[model samples]
Target: TETLTNRDNHNYDDVMDFYLMDNGPNVTGYVNKGFDVHLDDFYNNLTADKKSSFFLTALHESQHTMGLQHPFESGFDEWVHNSKIDSTGSSIMSYNERDFNGNNDLRIYDLAVLHYRYGVNPNARSGDDTYGFKNFEQNNADGGVYIWDGAGVDTFDASNEKDGNGVYVNLTAGSRIYRGGNTIPNWTNKHLGLQEINGS
Candidate 1:
């Protein structure tokens, strides 16, 4: 009979919350000066094509980190207007893919941008130097390359390049010389500022 009388009901609830604590103020002073480049597992195992692609990707990303922007990023018309330098045949920053589809080295405009950004390396290859296809078939197969020489009387020896298509050598500063072949890209090789060129 006493159990029939009920007391006032009471309820209790429990709640939990989480908050991320700030460690400290953000770091400063290295705004555009430093960057981290990350390559995934694919980089560890590269085929011939992948190697070229990896090289291009590394150069392209490094240029971005160094404050370089693609000409077509904003100025679409300008990129088309300056097709010479705004194309992949000339600039690595260019999105336009040309005959040099699998270019392994930096193009002319890429070299220009780097020089403009960091200034020329005055101490590069100051001694007498000779550049040529050590192994013609192998070099041609590997694709284009650029030779940067700094204040030296250099020579371009094409003795080993027995390609009957003929070799065109330009011994001027920042000019490219290439062999005539339907197989070779338009701008396949260049030796910047060479004093001598022989062995045709």
Candidate 2:
């Protein structure tokens, strides 16, 4: 995976997006965390009672990496907003973020795909992983993602890639993180990066 550059970015065949803490390639979108909208902003973007942006972003991008493009991105732009309000079509691959409804989860079909990819068959429905200060994220058909910080701190780094203490925790796709009794830190996708328009 090559590092992402402001002048060298395209959705196809791109695998990674790395940045510095400065005015570098700041990011906001999933699959690519910029200096401006990195991971911590994932949580910061949510409402008080509905703060699941981080987890959802993680899952969203994970789904993308798993070959599940946004419903519209699947060469089906006609389904973008065919109905009134937002209709995600009830698939995690849908862009209907408003449907997050605090329980934004991977649909059954998606889980089926992931299970097959991971060599594990899923049941009808594995239980729901609710969002709260716990910072729980879905791992696989079994366990979950865990992020632990000493000093009783419960926070992520400004970039949401590391712990507040500057330690890198393993956050892989198809997993979730939980901060039990810890200051879930703030991450930043807070930098400014220019977008590359077609034929620019």
In model 1, where do residues sit more than 4 Å from their true spots? Answer: 1-33, 44-48, 75-77, 125-149, 152-200
Please give, for residues 1-200, the per-residue lDDT of candidate 1 as tens digits. Answer: 11111112222121211112332354111113334443343555668766667667666656655445665554334335656556676666777776567666666556654553444566977888888853222123222355666767888988877868777777765455666564534332121101111111
- Give RMSD (Å) of candidate 1 vs. truth: 23.6
- Candidate 1 lowest-lDDT run of ten: 191-200
Tens digit per residue, CA lDDT, model 2, 47-134 = 8655554456666666665445554442344445643112332445555655434555665335434443343323332333222222
Model 1, position 96, has a per-residue lDDT of 78
Q: Each candidate's lDDT (Cα)?
A: 0.51, 0.39
Task: Assess the local accuracy of residue 181 in candidate 1 as a C-alpha lDDT between 0 and 100.
Answer: 62
Q: Which stretches of candidate 2 lie over 4 Å from their true place?
A: 1-27, 32-50, 82-89, 112-200
TM-score of each: 0.44, 0.36
Q: How close is each model in CA RMSD to the real structure? A: 23.6, 18.6
Per-prediction backbone clash count: 0, 24
Which candidate has the top score in lDDT?
Answer: 1
Q: How well does candidate 1 score on lDDT at residue 1?
A: 13
